[model samples]
Target: MHKSDYIVKYLANSTSDYVTSAQLGDFLSSSTRTVLRYIREIQAESNEHGFEIISNKGQGYRLIIRDKAAFQNYLSNSLAEHEKSDLNKLECQIARQLLLTDYIKLDDLAQQFNYSRSSISRITSAVASIFEGYNLELESKAHQGFSVQGSEINIRHCINNLIFNSFTMYQTARMLQVDDLDWNSFKKAATDIVKSRGLNFKQELLIQFMKYCYIAVNRIRNKRYVNFEQIKDLEFDIVSDESLTLMLELIQLICPEFEKTTESQWELYYLALAWEQSIYPVEKLHDPNPERIKFFLDIVEKAVENIKNYYGIDFTKDHQFLKDLAEHISICYWKYLLNVESENLYLDEVRSKYPTAYYYSVEIAACINESTKTKIPDDELSLITLHFAAKIERENRKQIKTIILCSTEFGITELLKSRLNKQYGDIDVIGICTCDNKVQLCHDNADFYISADQIEQSELNGKPILQLSPFLDEEDCHLLDEFIARLNTTVPLQSICEPNHFYILNKPAKKAHLLNYLCDYLLQEGRITEKEKADIFAREALVPTAIAPHVAMPHCIIQGSSFLVFAVLPKSIIWDQTRINLIILGCFHEGDNQIKNLLKQLYTVISNKQQVDKIIGCKSYDEFIKVMNDFVGEELC
Candidate 1:
């Protein structure tokens, strides 16, 4: 894998986790300074997506991706733009050379590219600088040669940064280099570490091992040489202070078998460090309840199948490191589910043992069951209407002091004020005022103002202004109650006894036809006229009533209509290429107070999938009606 690819994978996996600089340095056998550089590059690349690589005083570095899709989109756009930049063209060639080779020597790269050693150094330095800024260190060990060190997360960040910043021509040309990176070598090393450590290994340790191998191989491919003094300074405490002597001994043992060059010495040191880091206590898998284990096993099997189907990446191969990872995860999951005592049950431990596996496991659990399931009340309309009245009344009560304004100075203002006070006795009118003059003192003291005429002169912005002209009639109060009901009430149950009642459809394929059919049904049933349907259509055009996926509830109140009507469509249909399967067509008659209760109940029933599916699956209309009656209850007519 390319250095950048390894970095991207690391950061993408370590959500809300910290990675220390020393840990990164040891993994890559590089200096902490170099790791810092890579982090800066990553931060710059992820800048637009709010990709922040935060560094705490004591902690090392972390990749915070607020918007995943936005970041990906930004990268795509950046890549397109980078292709046309001169700086990007040069960087591509540098990356290409680093990728294509097995072990790159700075001198060799300069010779091949016909650039001076100094020029090659500058290019490598520029690339290395990118890693440094992101808290990623690019270091070279005496035996390991060179490697990128830092937070694995930041390393992943560097890859994305590089990919997005690099030229398109370089991307296509770099394919050969990508192939030569020997991703299998790192995978093998990771698998071996897991096997040697047993199921007890922390997921983070496995991740660290994989990252180490990835960086080592890339360094060799890049032919980026690290000086011996730099390798000696690496702070690796995995091997005790005395064990450092053992590492030297091990390196000596391995070095003679290879070409014994300076590069070979470095490679041996890297191998020795890998061996030391691989040592850990093996965890024995506890025999969990067979039934519980099987349940988790089935889930894992299905997940594996889905992964194969969706991504086409087979994990069944012998060399597949993630295969063992999957097995370990299943064991942990079984232990967690059955409440069995196990050493590897904690999420942190699971993360350390199988980072990727832990992530997928959580996703599976979330998909199986949501965190919350709140059911709305059955008498939705009445409940909602009550809730609306309570809310509005509460707000109105909060407006204690008010000034009544009138354009025509008659007893009309006092008469309306008396009625308002009778209904809402808490309201205190400071005095009667006129819109013809500015009353600054009253404006400051009063919470709201009652007016009869249009008053454009107002210094107060959010202060309540009640217009009495529009609200004088009894019909207007009913309208206010209905509007309040819609806001306050939960969705109501469909009144199955009402022939012209509306039902919300949940299926996507049948939504459009259902809507059209309901429109025609209302007209034919004499519940609505063509002109009213046209009016409803115009309202729908202004603001669609389709609230959720596969469901649309359309309604409009017209004058002189007596009873409400409903039409139900269960199957989904396409509307503007968007499938809406469920629809509830409600036609409310003038002065109908029960519409709120009906709507509330319908919303409650529709919200419950079990209830909705049961209603939709009925073989006969009577069976469907029976299910509706049972759900809404026979007590509610």
Candidate 2:
């Protein structure tokens, strides 16, 4: 979200409380100083947007809505733009241009897009990551603009994935606007050929093969072809004579230049590989490559073992789950080899519905990448999460729906909700209800009530309330454990890492040395095995977790209960090409069986850089906990 929009939304949700710069900074995950600057910028134009930010003397700042409709409209538009930005429209436009030709002159693109030369330059850089995964590089030339240089095989695979898989064939064709091709005729001929040849083509990917066949025809006509030398490492049994003959016939439909000759062998292999991949089992004539399957299966098995070692959950016992995971991993590996990607239509749904499974899939992705040196795209990860989601659903645990009854104090209600949600993921905090909405919102919504005061008989509605302080005490917390039906203890940070795991590094240290200290300590205590320690380092090697400004969170899942080992450097340290002042080594012990509460616990602390700075400022354990207690922040009864 835009800085101003986030600040405004946070203040709007804050109710009557006047949020301080400290609180706003924490909410924005920025330093209080940065928040103050943001507040100045927002306030400068606040009146125009129909809201007034009232800065009170002792209390922080409160948003006063002068025009509700206008404010809501502005907020909605800002968030809509934010959500669309991870992959923006203009970036996609430029990517399509790259697919159409070898190079695009920035000067020409600037005139065509009606954007400034600098804007066009910035956009092409943004779209570079899309091709990076396919091992393609965008090289700028003095006069030629920029050229996308890569293997022809990778180029074809990248084009097929982007055009067809990401969008509908109809939408893709319009986006590309390739002038002379007949979409309907091409589709018909391709479908007819597949039907006549009796190839078991995947319905979703059949069109992709056809599109690639079109690329092959165009490229060969331009005197470009896949030479044998480029594919020296290609390994796969040849398709049956019948399949090769069919492949030849399929290519000859449009390009008679393609021939059954020694020179054309590799070109034929290129088309056959694309065709076989489009086929459901890869090849009907040969069993799926046993070595390739085993290679990925080994990595999956090891990752599964790592999960068991770390989270204490065993997927090995569930034969079907392992089998399913292995099969999906094999398919994903196949896509990786071919530089192709598939769309996960249910990615967002899977993330919201089975968040825990989605996180587990993240670990699996990292493990696979470390072993195989390949990135597993989110779409593929979501599919893997479904496999984990199946196991998650089988457990069939009931979630405890909760409603927090508290006053609209500056930070009281927020503190309570964060505590409850982080303590147990299944304990859903439906919403915080005040004296006004308590009777109405609580009646049908809450399974139980967490209140700071006794409920009057008239407002009781026969529901039990756990009367407790805003800062939850041990006895009331124990009662909560029993009330919520969870057997796990509510482990506070003090109990987990306050005294021993916490560190204030006085001397300068490299990122590697620093992490080694944390891992070595865990290893010495036998809290984490040597292999698990190696897993953490291996993960860091594959992907750097550093963010710009001043924050770095190097985290991993582990066996036993979750705990954190935190450290603060006296000065800035260069970590994986970024400088950071604070480091949080989060060892999450998610059982993965129940809803994951630990993730909720860590998210509030690490969600922003300013939050990390605030954490680093605390010199003592008591101050740290006190500051964090408020970070979950606010409520009362």
Worst 10 residues of 1 by lDDT: 372-381
Backbone collision tally, model 1: 74
Find the 10 residues in a row with the least total lDDT in model 2.
628-637
Estimate, for each residue in 566-628, the C-alpha lDDT of model 2 and write its tens digit: 787768876643457877776766554322554434543454345677877889766777766
| lDDT of each residue in 474-512, candidate 1, tens digit only | 754543333322333332333323633535545443333
Question: Highest lDDT among the candidates is held by which one?
Answer: 2
Candidate 1 TM-score, true structure as reference: 0.26
Q: Tell me each candidate's TM-score.
A: 0.26, 0.49
lDDT of 1 at 468: 57
Give the count of colliding residue pairs in each prediction: 74, 19
lDDT of 2: 0.65
